[model samples]
Target: MDARAEHDSDTRAVSRAVSELARRTRFPIAFGGLAQGGAIHVSSIVGARTRSLDGLVVQETRGLGGRAFAEKRPRLALDYRTSRSITHDYDGQVLSEGIATLFAVPVLVSGRSRGVLYCGSWGQAGVGDVVARPAFAVAEELATELRVGEEVRRRLATMPPPATSDAMAPAMQEELRESFAELRSIASTVTDTAVRERLTKLEQRLAALSRPAGPAAEFDVRLSPRELDVLACAALGATNAEIAAELNLREGTVKSYLQSAMGKLEASTRHAAVAKARRAGILP
Candidate 1:
């Protein structure tokens, strides 16, 4: 995809994510990608139509999402709309959404916090681990996808111009696709999310190399990269603990990502998720 098309895809991906998250967790979900001046700007949401969250500027360390991004970890408050745990910069929106409890998770990429992913309830103390897991998993997947896009652009920038028409030939495309498979094979041995994200980017870059570089394929639906990983392993008949060991996360965490993925895929079981993802071209 060209730069402009890629940018649009990223926008759609984030926008779609909030709605998908809201549906999956049955809680109001919101997302704010980091922008200049070190602030996260809320631009997309689901189940928050009552609030004017669009362009709601959240300064660093100023709100729940801010604290999560600043601390590079998940932050939670049982009664956010009136809680003293965080500043009230965006409480207007929260109150508008009728959120009495809330939680935020940082979208960390390459050791840097890129933004915040949040979900909350209209009642006090309404969220718990089972609800939070898929949300965090979705955040992780977005971080990974963004990091991959960045790396692809970086690598393309470093490459010299094409010397001839043969530069992007079909034969070369096949070779690049092979490299993608190899990278996935190597990445399975890695454990760290950040590191695996880099490899995933490399694989994505290779796959892109195999396709025409004119424009990105129209991808209207957003899928979690981390979800695909877990589901892909499950497709291979790996157990939850085994997937967790390979992904360098706790077994329960793996389950949450899987559940979130299943919701996104509209599947009721691991096998069903794998099948749906395959049909959706989110898996191979």
Candidate 2:
């Protein structure tokens, strides 16, 4: 389909994600697209009334979303009104929405900010790292979909079928199908409910293009930088001993990081750690 159509579909997919996140999470959810004037405005809401908060645009370098977009990573606030690290220019909107605990993650594509995803806990603060992980988890999944969809659209534009032939060649058709299939597999493998729903839609689109195969599943599990590095090594079939050799970390430290990841994923072994990490979009 066209770009607008693709964008609309993605928007709906995000809406569904917000809904699912609201249902599964204790936080209120909001997704926002960065407008032309460098303002972040809420695009969808869940666990709260959907009203027009258009007047509340998170300006660049200001507010939670702006800081997220500026920093190009996730930001958390135990209390929005009292958070001193970031600007509170959107205090009116926060008050209107009755938001307290706030977490924001920037949605990036090729190192550029495209949007922001946020979760809020009303009346209470101190969401801690527990909520932070899941919030980043959702944002990362959404970013992947946006990136993949953009890539798919670009590929389609460059290789349209001849006027006298089918809409797509057999090989192209197969590629699309395979890509979609793999996308579906990745989506299915994700344990987080919100992530699964958003990815399912992206997978459907890719499948219609071909069998749905592309890059191996690369998920961002919001592990600390060191944890991510260790997981990457583990995914390559490195033993803790080998991982220690590569990273110059003690085997006990390597094992500890692995154990922490496994615990977060509720997994039982190193193999299960990799599997669960893959499923959670923490590792490729």
Candidate 3:
């Protein structure tokens, strides 16, 4: 698939998951991922627009999203109307839209907090713990899907684009450039460093794809999803212990994933694997 198409597909998947969850629950649901710049970027919204928060980004340690990312766990405010512990940078936005009850859960993959999922109510001021817990699980699934999507995109990058002689129209080419720029901007804001860096590279590749015809760029070594998962955790600067915790695997299993990733990348150490993966288009 084309880079643009891949991004659209990922977003669509997120939307579908969130929509399904929203339909089954009373509160509105929104799913988002961490951006490179350590900011939480909303990816999908599936509920009442009681607020114009479908695609909003919340900075680290600022609001509920920020707090969730900071604590690397679910953060909740029983009543948004009277939460004194959390910052209210986006409160006006919520208040204007009548979003009173709110719960935020950090999405984690490979021991790293990726982004946040939010479930909220417009009429009530308190969010039940029961709702918050299940919301976290759903967010975890969304995060996994994102990791899988990233892996697929990496694989697609390895499969060389079809041979063609014709160039795109100038207008279409410019549009691609604009789209790539926006994507890069989004990539830059992800809270996870590894995801952000990989996204940056992906953005660069897409930009290159938009350039006038040239020799196809060579791809580096590829990795399986499991290996990619391990490398992603390592790239996040997590130890095997941390990776194990994140993936719910034994530390030995984490080591095995790292070893396999290293072997694929022909790396001699964890650092080398991460470095080579980045160079090989495996780590982001």
Each model's TM-score?
0.60, 0.59, 0.51
Please, what is the whole-model Cα lDDT of each candidate in the order they appear?
0.68, 0.64, 0.64
Ranking by TM-score: 1, 2, 3
Q: Is candidate 1 or candidate 2 better by TM-score?
A: 1
- Root-mean-square deviation of Cα positions for candidate 1 versus the true structure, in angstroms: 11.7
Q: Residue 259 lDDT in model 2?
A: 79
For candidate 2, the 10 contiguous residues with the lowest summed lDDT are 207-216
Backbone collisions counted per model: 0, 18, 11
Better of 1 and 3 by TM-score: 1
**Best-fitting candidate, measured by TM-score?**
1
- Please give, for residues 183-241, the per-residue lDDT of candidate 1 as tens digits: 45446555446557656665554544534435543444465666666776676678999
Off by over 4 Å in 3: 1-3, 28-36, 49-51, 125-129, 155-284
RMSD of each: 11.7, 11.4, 12.2
lDDT digits (tens) for residues 1-284 of candidate 2: 68579868677656655665555456655555543467765667766654535545677778888988988888888777888988877787776777778877787867888777777777676766666666666666666666666765665665546334435565565444334433433343356665556565554444333222344344445565456556656766678898787777899998898878777666687778767665444443
Error of 1 at 261 (Å): 30
